[model samples]
Target: MPEAYLWDRPDGGVPIAVAASGPSSSALAGEYADGVIAVEPDAKVLELFDEAGGGGKPRFGQVAICWGPDEADCRKRVLDQWRWSPLGWKVNAELPGPDSFAAATQFVREEDLVRTVPCGPDVDKHVEAFNKYVDAGFTHVAFVQVGGESQPDFLDWAERELLPRLRT
Candidate 1:
């Protein structure tokens, strides 16, 4: 991952997808005007603390950074409450990337310096998911697919399908 991320919020209500890791924390903050809650794999807890939980104005709420206590132990915590968790509603299982709670938050309101790569689906999938995010409320998103044969196709598809729709 490049350790930097960006998301656009057109509707300004709810973000589309949550990525993963500390780099994407800003998006999480962007999603919440009040506060942000983060859920991550146990392996990434320390990374998240160092990246997002540090000192600053805090993005979402006054507290800004609220990390899940258990880390890996809190999969249910994320699935049940996190906005992106497809628990109650019919969320497109096809995500923009690794639907990590942290990533979801990072790509919402503010752009952050976090490495990210395209995940989930091919170019068509990316377009659909990105458009879905925008239509739903997200205004920010980028094609960050890492080293892969499909990278160019992903970008091309974005320009052809996604950009046209986004154009005012």
Candidate 2:
């Protein structure tokens, strides 16, 4: 095969994966790709992906998780950094600029963010958040912290507190 004409990857080649919003895209991923990077944490998507692919390879998931030592601070941080996330898929996908996203999410409340984003310090809450994807058939996970947290501290706390629970 010819060398990849575009895209960058480590070691000169990338394991291609599919970004799927639902069953249709997941089906395509299942058929031809290594795995699906799901945006929505829905078990049915994984089932469809596996079924379409005629059963397993690897299933991975990415979930936006915002947390801190303090729940209130975590909520505020989530609001400041990810308020636009609640704009829904259509607006989020079609919006061209940060201004559009900001304007679109102007009315969103912090409480509502809890529904879609894991925003708080409760260890169980965070564990449950990740478990939702894992239970849905994801073999791996992407813990994206959107709230501009101290990465080292977050990782430390997670390793000590979060990782243990998730492992079990």
lDDT string for model 2 (21-138, tens) is 6667878988988878875677887888888882767777888888787778877888888887666554677799988887888889999888888866788887887888878888
Q: Estimate every model's Cα lDDT from 0 to 1.
A: 0.35, 0.79
* Alpha-carbon TM-score of each model against the true structure: 0.26, 0.83
Cα displacement (Å) at residue 63, model 2: 1.6
| Deviation (Å) of 39 in candidate 2 | 2.5
TM-score of 1: 0.26
TM-score, cand. 2 = 0.83
lDDT, residue 27, candidate 2? 88
Tens-digit lDDT track for model 1 on 67-97?
2223232232323333342221123233445
Model 1, stretches more than 4 Å misplaced?
A: 1-127
Model 2, stretches more than 4 Å misplaced? 1-13
Candidate 1, residue 152: the lDDT equals 68
Taking every candidate in turn, the Cα RMSD to the unseen true structure, in Å, is 17.5, 4.5
